[model samples]
Target: MEEVKFGQDINKQKHKKMNQTVLITGASTGIGLEMAKQLAAKKFNLILVARSAEKLQEIQKHLQDQEGVTVKIFAKDLSNSANAISLYNDVKRENSKVDMLINNAGVGLYGNFTETSLDAELDMIELNISSLVALTKLFAQDMLILKSGKIMNVASLLAFLPFPYYSVYSATKAFVLAFSETLAAELEGTGVTVTTLCPGPIDTPFNTDSMLTTNAYKANKPMPASVVAESGVDLLLDGKGKKLVGFNNWFISNLPRFTPDFIMMKIKKNLASQRK
Candidate 1:
């Protein structure tokens, strides 16, 4: 596979045409919201999970009216970790099965590791790693029983190149990367596919306009949330392998292979840190 900045090769791109119900975590905002919109447009039934009940209600009504597809919204604070199983049970009670699962909820605290609040970072771990794993474990077992399903785990470019300020956040995503890739390999013959979406600095509230100061923002720029979501939804339904969004991002994910740890850290520091 050529790691070109020209974007994913059109020849290799896949977009399967199947109507499957998709449940997306963090579906009220940013990349998650964008994903919900794209999937709804494609006529897939949706199960949207987020922390905002009001926002979820609005989204449910809008998607239901506009797309004319069944939209189920669950207001869940998956940061609790234990709530992952509860949410799963809740969804199963309402709906018999989930054809696809998109684990997109995550949080990050930007600052020196020691300066950051331990409580906040711990909660982030629960949302970004623990809850994701819990849901994946639960849903994956069901998928294996049915002998068909897809799971999309959202990681980050920082997963490959750990940044200084986002130490805990990046580590969690690194865990996602390894966990997803290994799980994908494990589920190869089980008819349940696990695909990872590793997007770079996306122009979402999560990424923020403040990120313009970073070298990464200058070098790769911020891809629109819609673009990333489109790619993710397409990959999810099409049953493609892992995707790392952005042109420069694909190269960035592979840089660590050739660059020394010190040099890589310096570059990632510049990319993630404030630029003068």
Candidate 2:
């Protein structure tokens, strides 16, 4: 696929439908929150989802007051297996049409399989994989009926490789990356687009707590979560399929394919050492 250039002209070129609704999961913080702010700035009506109702309400007020966009908050734990379809049903019950779907709700678990609890891994799989897929099915069908919409899934650089410690996290992201590319093709000519935002080590609250970044090594360049969110939105709106966040990340993420497994392994080992 061709590399999509990110800029402002692309954003202004697309016109927003009056009161078009955008549903964003995990919108209470980090990249999801920034995406909500950017979309609200463009005057898209928003339905924000996350576990924290209080935080969501606060963000809703700020975005509505500042950007003058219609905003709604759904305080639900996306990690729950049943909540995915329930969230979709709630949106339908509220009579909101989903014009854009952002599958940004996810979690990460670091350490050996034995070191991570079964419950945590189950939760990660349900949220990062199952819930994401469930929500996509529901919202994509909605978009298919409308014959116009966009879906952006937040994947990670690890989607391209098998990380030593972050095995489950990488696996979940791989699913997202592959699913987004294939779905984009399937939805072609339907006036709907699906994009996977494969950001590398974003400086978000999520990464701050992860050993994947702390122990493994330094990022060649770490972008702010807001930058990733804004650029991702721009790419998806421009009908781009996949996006690499920072320039160095783009290079490093692709380098493993050409570099020997031994060298990549050493690099990953060094990076993992930083966790402690």
Candidate 3:
């Protein structure tokens, strides 16, 4: 693939349909849901994927009614690599021409690596890394053929450094960050852009899960999901390769370079200890 310069005008690309379609995984809630809402307002059709069919339908109806945009729902557990492939096949079968793909479905297991469930850690790897790669591969092919499309992969602030209790989760996000960057480079002039969003903690049900509810977790305020979603979508549309959602997150992501390894590790460990 030839290397294309960044910041080509996405609005100028011609699509099969007058209105472009954006397929977002984990669209039932949180940042993904907010992305859907923001895009709907922009008149882009949406394909919402998640594990909750009921929630997807509710969002589907709401977007359709409020924004007058077409919304399709696919409820599947993407943690399974096979299901991720199935999602791509199903979208092709439906003849949905996706102009953008958002890989946002992920889970985190917070605990000491040794104490965490190995099975759950494996599942997280599958969902956060493998499934993302699978979906990106499938859709990127179509986008290549069309010579136009966008991809946004959701990483995390944790990707920049190792977190003690979030060892596996942080590792998975690091993979996502590295993978997305390399893939973006490979697809450079292919008329397809890959953007990674590395957001800090967000106030959402995802953070409310059992592993994340400790008093230490509650002590740190989280950014609003809507804020992260808006910035992510904006950067993706702007053809940026990677974005950290907030100033503090951006600072922290870069701080590791200047800080000593031992100091960073100690700070991370101290932060991790709060989860109990």
Candidate 4:
């Protein structure tokens, strides 16, 4: 009996080592880049996808030299509606198993809806909402078939509010939060787990590129990208359904769910005033 138990333990360890590959979208920069670094450090085989082949090659080189992890790059524009499913098909062609999926490819338009170009806003919707939903469904079906997998969707603190300037971004994140929560419930019996990470003000390229840091209020309350990445990954691995990155963030994220709308609006108004 002891011999049989020891053999089972060894088999489990071997299986864990062999199936540590993760596919992360938008991995050329920002949170996705940081996540790739973290996962590689843990000896996971990585498949990094982004629009820029040059940048993806740079990250691949760094990971290969630094961590010696198997790193593959897929350069594709995820904003294209069919690209998400195309990505899945490409990965399967490589004969690689996706043990985890990180749907982090998203863009934000930082102006009033009317002020922002219709085309750009539509692209934002394609990247942030449509692609995420598609990838989650595509890869998750594979995971379901294998009877094991994990998913982490990067949401935002804006998910808790209907903010003025970042209207579309907030709405997309709200959809992510609700969608991930419901998916987690449905997949409970399946060996698959989903975690939506609602991080508050991450300090990364996302801030500068998305015009988030330009906001005086957000720029002042920035948290390191590594901190958010680590916390988010840990929570997802631990099977935590939903996690807001910081302690204060968790409080504030839940606050809107309980606080009266009129009171919340009053607080938002006061906060907006201080920023100006």
Candidate 5:
């Protein structure tokens, strides 16, 4: 019986060693953090990237202690194209095979496009669209060589509609959705899959300062970050193409397509007005 138990322990160690490694951006908090936790529980080695080095270290230590999965942390400001490239290069330098990539780093500004700070908007674009594309291209090449990888691009339900106040953010997410879907098709049969996650307002640090005070935010209870993270990871691993979290969010995302343009615009305008 002791020998049998020892064999079982050895098998578990072997299984853990065989687990794939996933790299996640924005992994210090919110959906990214939750996704890391879930994946760690599953024994996937983790490479966590975020601007907050302290937070990343904290999480890395905790997850390593709890799940016994390897955790690597990189603090990078992906808003800069140079930094985004550096991140990919650094990962390559480590000789780590990234089995999955989560493009979750993003920012949003709330206000009229004209009134919003131009610098802030540009930074958002760099982080949301440019960085996402750069990272995808860089890692995707490696994945192609391996012929096995999964990618999850975190878009938003706002991608489907014209958001008056969140103009640039909405536009970026729209690009993500379109880019992810097209890439999924292009990569078909290549053993690499792309999944786009369009979640509604999520209760994360990302929203705490900006969106949480709005009436629209209040009207719809923000989905817990863990719930969204779990759903997204599930879809990504399943090789699903596009997923919108929450029934209401899914309905809203689809509703805009059928609604009249003017009516849709008015509704969006009203929702935007709720921001204080």
Candidate 6:
């Protein structure tokens, strides 16, 4: 679907309740895509952003055809920090007012720090941290000006329980959790709220790959993306503050508080390494 021009009425569209639009990044797959589907079911217009134009278009058409809602797709590789700002500009120019922003795009590496490619880790950092910050800042400003909007930043269970093999990825998520907590407090009375979603291992495209077959990863059963997104959508729309998905995940995230750091790290390292 083409971008909505400035003069068009957002509420007068065919879908009666699709006036409020949600912008979701990494929407071609995984939690991001699942959240998009759920939001569409709730009659929210969608602005889906991802790297693959073909995939984005496919989802766009699927949603529009099935839900009778406006679906706009933007193909963007947000790993490059500048692209985040560019995306914000493009949305504004297209006259799309994002009522909610979901920073769901991220990357993870499953290998020893020394063994993993430096470039890959750098790209992961750029996508997981830099772009998230850029988009949150840009859109959060817009929301403040309007005095309305919700933002959901997807962190990981590893945000609080950083594992060894996923060093950089875990660190990036930790930043997301910390940043969202502070920002939520700052925007408390502004009417705009920020929510952090911390999911443990997810049955998303990222983990289905054979790359993460370590003993620790295999031991922990992953939650379905649909289930996690269901909680995420509700928390973002109806509730506020950080949400740790599932009881087990919440328990694991708090283990660090009870167990000493050095002992916990050793245990985490053992779990992250392959069986010898």
lDDT of residue 92 for candidate 4: 92
Stretches of candidate 1 off by over 4 Å are 1-19, 208-210
- Residue by residue across 151-245, what tens digits does model 2's lDDT show? 99989888986577788888999999999999999999998899999888766678644564464445454678898998877976674878888
Model 6 clashes, total count: 0
Model 6 / residue 261 / CA error / Å? 1.8
Name the better of 2 and 6 by lDDT. Answer: 6
Give lDDT tens digits, candidate 4, residues 1-276. Answer: 999999999989866854589899989877789888988887788999999999999999999899888999999898886988898899999898999989988887666578888887788888898999999998999999999999999888888765666778889889998999999999998999999888877676665444543443563487888888888668766757777778877776676778898998776544433333
In order, what lDDT does every prediction score?
A: 0.88, 0.84, 0.87, 0.82, 0.89, 0.89
Q: What TM-score would every model get versus the actual structure?
A: 0.90, 0.90, 0.90, 0.89, 0.92, 0.92
Global Cα lDDT for candidate 1: 0.88
Flag regions of model 2 displaced more than 4 Å: 1-15, 208-217
| Clash count list over all predictions | 0, 9, 0, 0, 0, 0
RMSD of candidates 1 onward, in order: 7.2, 5.6, 5.5, 2.7, 3.3, 6.1
What is the C-alpha lDDT profile of model 1 across 1-276, one tens digit per residue? Answer: 466633555323322323468999999998899999998887788999999999999999999999888888888999998889999999889764699999999987787888889999999999999999999999999999999999999999988888888899999999999999999999999999999999988877776444567777788878889999998988897856689897789998899999999998888887777777
Tens-digit lDDT track for model 5 on 191-228? 99999999989888777455676666866788999999
Give residue 17's lDDT in candidate 4 (0 to 100).
Answer: 55
Clashing pairs for predicted structure model 1, backbone only: none
